[model samples]
Target chain A: MYAAIDIGGTKIAAGLVDSGGELLARHEHPTPAEEPVTAVEALLGRLMADPRWERVRAVGIGSAGPIDAAKGTISPVNIPAWRDFPLVARVAEATDRPVTLAGDGVAMAAGEHWRGAARGRENALCMVVSTGVGGGLILGGRLRPGPSGNAGHIGHMCVELDGPPCPCGSRGCLEVVASGTAIAARVGSTSAIEVAEAARAGDAAALASFDLSAKALAAAIAGTAALVDIETAVIGGGVSKAGDLLFGPLREHLKEYARLSFTRDVTVQTAALGGDAGLIGAAALVGHAEV
Target chain B: MYAAIDIGGTKIAAGLVDSGGELLARHEHPTPAEEPVTAVEALLGRLMADPRWERVRAVGIGSAGPIDAAKGTISPVNIPAWRDFPLVARVAEATDRPVTLAGDGVAMAAGEHWRGAARGRENALCMVVSTGVGGGLILGGRLRPGPSGNAGHIGHMCVELDGPPCPCGSRGCLEVVASGTAIAARVGSTSAIEVAEAARAGDAAALASFDLSAKALAAAIAGTAALVDIETAVIGGGVSKAGDLLFGPLREHLKEYARLSFTRDVTVQTAALGGDAGLIGAAALVGHAEV
Candidate 1:
């Protein structure tokens, strides 16, 4: 069995997963917004209390990044109190087992590549298009977390040279135009879910907002395809739940941007694992080193 | 020893290279423009006529792309007559040695990673920024040719979603804005060399043109860094000869674009191999499979 932990802005989740990618036990706790480290420790304690913890051979932790896998540290954007936190060392000390670490994006890709839509794909980009867009890459049939564990940080790539300024200090980043936050901001809606509801009701403003986000996503995806020669992209998260509202326009815009011969046949697919992906991916990271 | 061939739109050059990547003997011929295959065969025959050919154990060919390494075929954009031409099969038949094929960009990167600016770097981007921009990537201490061998085709990556139309049918590609052709067009000059001369003479328009191209290049480089976590970018080709006329502005803009912690330290260096990168890189391809 593998022990998995997922550190996010709002929640700390832990689970015990078997070799077959099955989650046998799980636990979750709301993240202490101002003090996430303490919450992580508490969540770890709760998970260890389960009898299955003794069966765990390795522990894998997936945290929002920028993570330094070499240094075993993480500094998630939404968690102000955890800048450069030594996650791997602390977790290994607490669990008393060998530990592996990866960025959330990397974890997500690992999970999908191991058992989700990206399974059997030699090269793919798996993405989480939530409040902010996040992603990981599978290259040469292996999940590549990159040296710093940020190989698939596609959200920050500049899709527009002169589009708009992003909070990450770059202009025209894909996240600024394609994330759920961006989609809501485009239609002046409170949330992407609300915008989706409006679009379902035939609201032109909401539909156009989704289209704009899709256009930016298409450009970024096509650009990635050109750079790495990936032919498939698996998308998940709240914004992706909008279904055809996003994929339809995304596919349409992809046709326009992915015009190069190698990139022309690029395909988009919905992520199959949903919210469980982070936990499943964290578990998969325990074995990823062999790949 | 290895045999290397570089097939460009205007020239077909072949060389005998030692295991240490030293070019022993070489031959070249201008491409027939409309009948490049014949020129390539003639160049290969001349290269084999050298006594050094007896020492060669393998052959590597780097050609203008988009090349289908899987199919052992080439369909260069500039050489329309060679669509899906089976260059690898023909070369292998003539040479009677195992043959390897890669895009020119991949060859350039392999050469640089083997003996040039990117020699010791674990992850790097090696580029040829000429009339058209091209590049290849080194990841995890090895060159990655990607599935179709176009992994480092950075020129086609869109920096601007709504920028300008490229002949490849994409808008705002890095090549559309940062290629030597683009730089010269910005200054109403016939060539980037002429623009460089004018900029050296303190022409304001020429200086602005270089800056604009540098800014685009900086954005694309930063974007690539964010996507793949590469810290070093080695640039070659005619436009890179502009020196600080290009590097100064690129470094300045990189500071504004590469703001993420993992991407913040991206360093740009001039490619050390120069024009011979393609040849040496083609030679490098013979051993890339083992990596």
Candidate 2:
């Protein structure tokens, strides 16, 4: 048995996983943003209280970056209190088990590659379209986390050289155009779901916003396909639930920009694991490391 | 002994390499644009005439894309006659040796990582600034050529949403701004060397053109650093000879656009191997397979 944890800016989710990719137990709690230590303590309390924790031999934690995977440290910009936090050590101390660390996106890719949408694919990219856009890569059947565990941070890849100024100080990053936050900002809505629903109802303003976002995403993906030569992209997260409202324009833009024959053949699909990908991917590390 | 060959749009270069990365013998010939088979055959004839060919154990060929590395076929856009050409088989038939194929940029990265500028680095990006811009990646001490051996085609990444349209049909690609071709076009010059000389001589037009190119290149690199978290980028090829004319502004732009603390620390440097990288990298693959 293995324990997998997905640490997000808003919440902490833990799950007990078996060898065959089944979830035996699951729990969630609000993440403590006040302090990194306090948050870990709260998570540890929850894990220890669970009966399944006693049988798990290893633990995997996935969080937002920029992270130092080698040192198991994280300094996520979204969660300021985690600066230089020894996340792996803290979790290990609390759980009394071997621990592995990775960025949330990388974990998601691993999960998808092992049992989700990318199960049979050799080269693929998995992206999360939640509050923010995040990405992970599986190239040549290996997970690429880069030197500082930022290899799959596709949200920051500049898509619109002149579109809009992003929080990262770059202009027109994918995150600025295609993410949930970007959708909300563009439609003057409080959440991405609101924009999705509005577009579904044939609202011109909302549909245009979705179209623009999807086009930007498609352009970025086409460029990425040129760079990495990957044939498939697996998209997940809350915003991906918008479905055809986003995919139609995305396909059209991809065809418009893709010049290389190999890149033109690339396919984009929605992720199959949904929200459970993070948990399953974290658990997959126990077996993947041995390979 | 190893044989490395760089097949470019304008020229073909062959070098005999030793285990220590020294070029024991070298040869060059203008690439024939009349027909694909004839051009390849002519190059092969010259390469076979070299004394080093007798002792060479393996062959490596680097060419323009879009290539099918697994199938050993090439279909470079500039070489219109080479559509779906079986490059590896023909080369192997002529030389009676095993051949490995990679993109020009990937070969350059391998050469640099093995014995040049990136010798000690485990993760780095090698960029070639020539008639066209191209890139290659080294991650976790291994060459990453992606599924079709086209992993580091960074030049095509969109850097400006409103920038000029690229031959690839994308707008604002890095190649459309930072390549020697782009620089020449901007200055109405015949070649990159002329633009570089004019910039060195304090020509306002030339300097401005380079400045714009450098800023775009730097912004793109900053975005890549945020995604891949690499430590250094080793630059090579003809345009890189401009030195500070390109790098100084590139560094400034990187700092301006870099929002994450980790990305701000990425170092950009010149490639150590001047011209023999292609052949050396090809030879490096004598005992290796795609990774």
Best by DockQ: 1
- In terms of lDDT, the best-performing candidate is 1
Q: What lDDT score goes with residue A162 in model 2?
A: 62
Candidate 1 residue spans exceeding 4 A from truth: none
Model 2 root mean square deviation, Cα atoms: 2.1
> Which 10 successive residues of model 2 chain A have the least lDDT summed?
A35-44
Q: Model 2: residues >4 Å from true position, as ranges?
A: A49-51, B46-52, B285-291
- Residue range B1-291, candidate 2, lDDT tens digits: 777777777777777788778888777777777765666667667767887668878887878876778899888878877888898998899889888888888888888888889888877888998888888888778777776766788888777655788888777788998899989999899887899899899999999988888887787777777666678889998988999999988888777766665677888999988877777766655533534
lDDT of all the models against the reference? 0.90, 0.80
TM-score of 2: 0.95
lDDT value, residue A168 of candidate 1? 88
DockQ of 1: 0.86
Candidate 2: docking tier: medium
